[model samples]
Target: MISQLFSGIAVLSLIVLLLILLLRRLKQPYFIAYIAAGILLGPHAFNIIHEPDVIKQAGEIGIIILMFSIGSEIDLEYLTRNFYKPLLITFVQILMSFICMYSIGAYLDWKITIILLTTFIISLSSSAIVFQYLARTGEIKSQLGMITCGVLLMQDILVIPMMLTLNFMSGNTVSMQQLIKVCAGGLLMILFLRGAITKRLFKIPMQKELTADHELQIFIGFSICFTMAWISGWFGLSTAFGAFAAGILIGHDKATHWLGESLIPFRVFFMSFFFLAVGLQLNINFFIENAATIILISFTVIFINSLINTILFKLAENSWRDSLYGGALLSQIGEFSFILMTMAAALKLVENYTYQITLAVITLTMLLTTIWLMIIQRLIYRLS
Candidate 1:
């Protein structure tokens, strides 16, 4: 087993490296190469890597780190100063999506639980993917980028309630009272961390020591991220949420600069595997069999999200260009949607075939986000 694992790792590494080179040359998203590598190594192809459990565990850690990094970059002060616009837009988008999906679900005879889950899933966007694209295109500090970040941040916070609601609706023991308590605790922690702990954190002689031994600084950074992640799990929240909170607590600190630099290589390595794990789940046969249905559903979801969000942004007084770009950036389903769908499937709320089809549709929508955004931008420029 050890030999097999090592051999599989080696082959996968080589595939990622070569594809990275090709993707770089083509000026395409490098993450897609990681997914392609996973597909090649997956059961659908050569079946080189058999221990999916190991990859999944590693990928989970990768997600934690990714969220941590994203959290670190978010300046709470800046977000607060201009929160209302994005918040209102996000709320409007959610209300509109919920009504539309509920009506569709009723017509299609879907259960209330499924309808609610599907509504929230399509209503939120991928913060990771959207922010990454924005950063790559030098728009991370732009108006649309900030708006997108704010909306995604709100969506991340709402994930807690969404999960608890799912538990309640699925006949789990979770109650509204318990849900409110959990939310209150989470909010209190956020305030405490941002107010007290963050001030104390910067007072530590972190910068002096970090400047001397870089490896120690990296260890300390990981320690902070992991500790927060552990605390979040103890509070019945996702570890990624905890890591992100930790990042926000340390946002723009002198230590964060070095920590970000030190963590890049690890993030790259782990996140590549994370994307690969997503690819491994892509059953080509299933996707091909349901290609038309998957594409149609995916397209409809993206279209509605983009249209609604764009209109909301415009109503919020954003320029047409920025609003359009923001809409395109957030048109796809988020990573948390996969978690919700998986949980729903486990609880037998969603049928097996429907679950598979949904996964395929979500994956396809995510895969197309970059190209779709590119096309949207081109059309925007042409029309303008």
Candidate 2:
């Protein structure tokens, strides 16, 4: 079993390496390479990986850690000062998405539950992909980047209510206890953020001892991340949000700067797993069969989402060029949408065909985001 595990890792690494090289030559994001690698090794292709569920579960850890890293690096002060902008943007974006999806569903004679599910799914933009792009370009701390990050964070927080709504729609009784826990969790998080911002700086325990021990640093960092994730999950919230909260606390501490630095390798490695799982789930045959419809839906989603965000950013006083680019940055549907999709499926809110199509559409949007951003950038350049 160990030998087979080693062999699988070797093959996966080789394929990913080759794909990354090719994508590099084409000036594409590394995520594309990771997803391509998954498709190549997935059941639809070589069928080399037999345990996709295991891979996918592991990939979720990557998301949690990635959120932690983003949280830690975030300029909390800037986010706090401009909090209303993101709040407004996310609220309007969600409202627009609901209205748009409701209109489509009505025209198609679809159910309200389906419309709500679809609305929440498309309303979110992929934090992982957008952050990766910003980090790669060294714009993560820039004004636009901060604004984008704030919007994404707001979207993440809103997932809790989305989940509750879905459960209620599906005839599942959400206990009052759960609601109270969620409210309490949210209050605590708000207070924590407030304190962190007010304090501006703090120190982690055993700072000096942790400085010299690279091995301990990794374990300590992961502990902080996952412990917070556990707490948030217990409170009926997004685990990634919990991890992000932990990161914010750590970020404010000068002594814990090394924590973020120490986890960089782990973040990159696990994040690849997340994208790989996305690729593994892509049904090539299904996509080929419904090529026209899927392609149309994918393009439509990107277009509508970009338009809504662009309008909102412009209203928030951003220049047209930056607003357009910001909209493009958030054009793709987010990873959390997949969780919603899965839940909707389990609750029988959507048909299997609908589930598969949504999955394919989300994957396609993510895959196309880089290309979409490039086109937007060029257009802005010419117009400027």
Candidate 3:
């Protein structure tokens, strides 16, 4: 038993170590490499290791910590000031991306469920990835970066209701009345929590870091996240919605700065596991098997996705450089896309081949995006 445990540690360690080396050498973002490492150990070609049930179960914690940390960093004043731009851009992006992608789905003769999933997925950019990239590049204070941040936050907020709508629509048991209740409850929760309830939380002082306060803060935070999640579930919304609502609430609190500082270390540590888990689920052979179709769809999505995002950003009174910046930040598929596809597959709305194809495309896009960004960085900075 001891040997088994040690071997697992060694394997995980080696995977992360290899990723670090690749990241340094390639001058690419570590996230791409991390996901690649997970794929290397996945049961596809390597067949050397599988992400056991235990590991996947543990990944749940990673998700929470990540969402929680995001909440803490959210500056209510900053975000609110920039909100209108993101709100408009996000709505346009979602509306246009769905309409355009859904048309392609029609040509592909995709089923309604598959079409819906595609629409949902295409509307999103990876929040975790984009935020981290902006921070790392020291652009978080730049106007373009600030706009992107607001847009991403708006996207997350938009997704909450969309998720509830999807859940209601996707269910066999849901009635019109039931759907109305869910929507109403969600709207009410968002307003109540984000407005009055959260304002009260912000009114409290956390000027001093009292002893043992860190533990209490974490408990309070996790409680709020879990509680919101539970309420969302009860109202037929997904757990992510609750997490988002939790973030918005936490963001409002004046003590959010300290909360951010306290939670970041934990977020970084655990989210590493989340990325690794994503990698371990990808099978190279499966991706290769569907290479032709996956490439076609992925490239098409990337091009159009970038175009739509660019157009929206420009319309929002942003510089052309800012438009391209937004495009570059988004020029790929994301985690939520895969989650929606998986759900569709389970419901027989899509086949396994569809899910595999989307995953392959998303991975390729993500990998390519790093290179895409670097090559354009100089030109973008000059123009901006």
Clashes of each: 0, 0, 3
Best candidate according to TM-score = 2
What's model 3's lDDT at 218?
A: 69
Q: Which 10 consecutive residues of model 2 have the lowest summed lDDT?
A: 195-204
lDDT of 2 by residue, 1-384 (tens): 568678889999999999999998999989998888888889998888888888888889999999999888888888888989999999999999999999999999989998889999999999999988898898888888999999999999999999999999999999999999999998987787677557654456788999999999999899889998999899888999999998988887767888888999999899999999998988888888998999999999999999999999999999999899999999999999988998888998888889889999999999999899989999999999
- CA error at residue 87 for candidate 2, angstroms: 0.5
lDDT tens digits, residue span 147-227, model 3: 887776666556555555456556745577877867887787767765654457434345465224888666666677778
Give the per-residue Cα lDDT of candidate 2 at 277: 91
Q: TM-scores across all candidates?
A: 0.94, 0.97, 0.85
Best by lDDT: 2
Backbone collision tally, model 2: 0
Task: Give the per-residue lDDT of model 1 (tens digit) for 185-246.
Answer: 68866776766444664443657767778888788879989998988877777788788887
TM-score between model 1 and native = 0.94
* Residue 380 alpha-carbon offset, candidate 1, angstroms: 1.9
Which pairs clash (backbone N, Cα, C closer than 3 Å) in model 3? 38-279, 38-280, 39-279
When sorted by TM-score, best at the front, the candidate numbers are 2, 1, 3
